[model samples]
Target: MQQNAPFELLSQLRSEAIALAAQGLTYSTQSAGTKNIAYVVNGVNFYCEATDVKEVSVCENLMIVPQTKAWMRGLVNSKGVLYSVTDLSLFAGYGRAIQAKKGHLLLLAEEAVQSSILVNRVIGFRYFNESDEMSSLDDKQEALDGLSAFVDKGYRADGQDWYRLNVSKLLASEQFREVQ
Candidate 1:
């Protein structure tokens, strides 16, 4: 009877392990698919990888810096950490953001950059499959003229085109690095 008891417990444990493995496989496959959270800046749709954004906050109490470019809005202190805020609309040649005080700030995930960009609003997430990707933006080139260097890809979803912003490339660019 004791020997049978041990064998039964082992069988139960093996089944549990098998069930857990199957669940893990399903979760991994679901997360591996492409999804993007789109945000709007001056009426244009833009998105970056989920890992590229650290946090989002409302624009408030920004300390203006001296002698910086127009696009460089100012510095903001968030939770004891200082972040340089760039006005995406102004930087992308879309003119000044009308609702500067009522805008949203996207804190970048870069450790060394410690910067964020101000946008008009956040439009929420939208999952895009491979079929939605556009190889070229030839027809809409003028629309993204200022951001062409940082935009690597585009997607069509919900009757609008979403541009993928490469945060790493934008942070490393000379134009972005030089605030003056």
Candidate 2:
């Protein structure tokens, strides 16, 4: 045996363990640039992969977690589990002057909390393998709160351009606060 063969064997074992763990993780199929992922709530699109999402199931109704306060738009039952729903269109600025309605609900169990983002209806899912996104949102619109990071730019809708959404922040914003 070689002089350092024992250490090499140990290193090989560690590499195998890492590979095994990685194999356990799964990533979704990336969509073509600007291919179109129907809006769950107007401009707000759901973007998730194995890295942050495992599986997505349709919810009949998610129970409202009142503690979430204004951000909470009642709740829906997701696979027997309750998820707090947020009027995503209203939460994403798409509802600027429009009113939110009862439509489809997106159950996001990514991190921190499992939130329900209410959308009009899930048209479909999109994938982006290689794409161009904006550097960042303009500082002038800092108060926009639910601003996107310009990920996957050039997405057009009705001759208009759009960007990807930030799921986490949308769930944490004060957009739900009413004029009390």
Candidate 3:
């Protein structure tokens, strides 16, 4: 046996544990660059910072609240916690999301405000570097003109334009505050 072998093993184990914790906080399908969770709402692809996401699951048994805005999908109980779910597609001026047999919800990270965003599907995690960001939207994509205010940046990958949404800004918006 080598001297100080036990101490060295413990040190290695500690380092590995820390790395694992960080990976949990920063989710990604790719190994390099900033991490994001890709999701689709009404055929539009969007990415949210991985750190801002708490969970993604198929939401069922939604309890619709009367006299609320059209975009409000109502309350859903997940893991004994009640979350106010919003139809992001309708909120963004798009038509209502297709209410199928099942629906997906992206839960926001625990913070001052708690809510879930109704999405068509969770498209898995994505990775993008600073260099991957595009300077502006394409000429034909005029409908996305106002989206710049809610996004951190825009990127093109896998033949699709992905907008990195700023969740914090979305949460802080007056429109969001008036959801009640």
Candidate 4:
């Protein structure tokens, strides 16, 4: 079902999935029912709501990104001004959803200067059915704070279902705040 990867990759992924499933999955809600985005990496599936995403682009040489207290991935030249990039996958606690290759950057607008998140391969966009029920994070909500919600059903690339990603909590995490 995959191509050109070591056997250990899948094995490790299996363990990783189990670990992830044991913990709480984060998500949010949207109008017209609920929506989420499916991002694929090394044959693995990662889901997030479409609203969480900002601008998508190919990876380019970043300019003067200060390598200080910030979780600055690098200083990328977006349009003209140097845009400080945030590596969300790192914060999400998973292998890169998208490698920092020639073409991959998801710029999300956070108040003013957009926040950049690196994904593996952004499969595409997806929406949820109204019939889907919500599942609040409860204790998990404390860590996520006022931004994240909970979801029971979301679309996976392989036609299976999963929980949506919580973009609000993600942006609010220590990993994001460090971006300067």
For residues 1-180, what per-residue lDDT tens digits would candidate 4 score against the true structure? 557467878788777767776887423334344455666533434567666666667778855355453335676777865556655444444434334674366776564655676656776766665554345345344332222342223443236434565566665566456644
Q: How many backbone clashes does candidate 1 have?
A: 0
Q: Find the 10 residues in a row with the least total lDDT in model 1.
A: 25-34
How high is the lDDT of residue 129 in model 2? 41
In candidate 1, stretches whose alpha carbon ends up further than 4 angstroms from where it belongs are 1-32
Q: Model 2, which residues run further than 4 Å from truth? A: 1-40, 43-71, 93-102, 129-160, 169-180
Model 3: per-residue Cα lDDT over 52-159, one tens digit each = 899997878889888888888788888888888888777777766647236688889956777988888888988876666789765525544445568767887778
Which of candidates 3 and 4 is the stronger one according to TM-score? 3
lDDT of 1 by residue, 39-84 (tens): 8887788998878888888988999999999999899989999999
| Cand. 1 TM to true fold | 0.80
Decreasing TM-score order of the candidates = 1, 3, 4, 2
Put down candidate 2 lDDT per residue, 76-112, tens digits, no spaces.
6555666666665555455442233446655665646
What's the CA error at residue 51 for candidate 4, in Å? 3.5
Q: What is the lDDT of residue 50 in candidate 2?
A: 28
What TM-score against the true fold does each predicted structure earn? 0.80, 0.49, 0.76, 0.54
By TM-score, who's the top model here?
1
Pick by lDDT: 1 or 2, better one? 1
Show pairs that collide, candidate 4: 58-103, 58-104, 59-104, 63-75, 97-119, 97-120, 98-119, 98-120
Look at candidate 1 and give me any clashing residue pairs: none
Higher-ranked by lDDT: 3 or 4: 3
Q: Judged by lDDT relative to the true structure, which candidate is superior, 2 or 3? A: 3
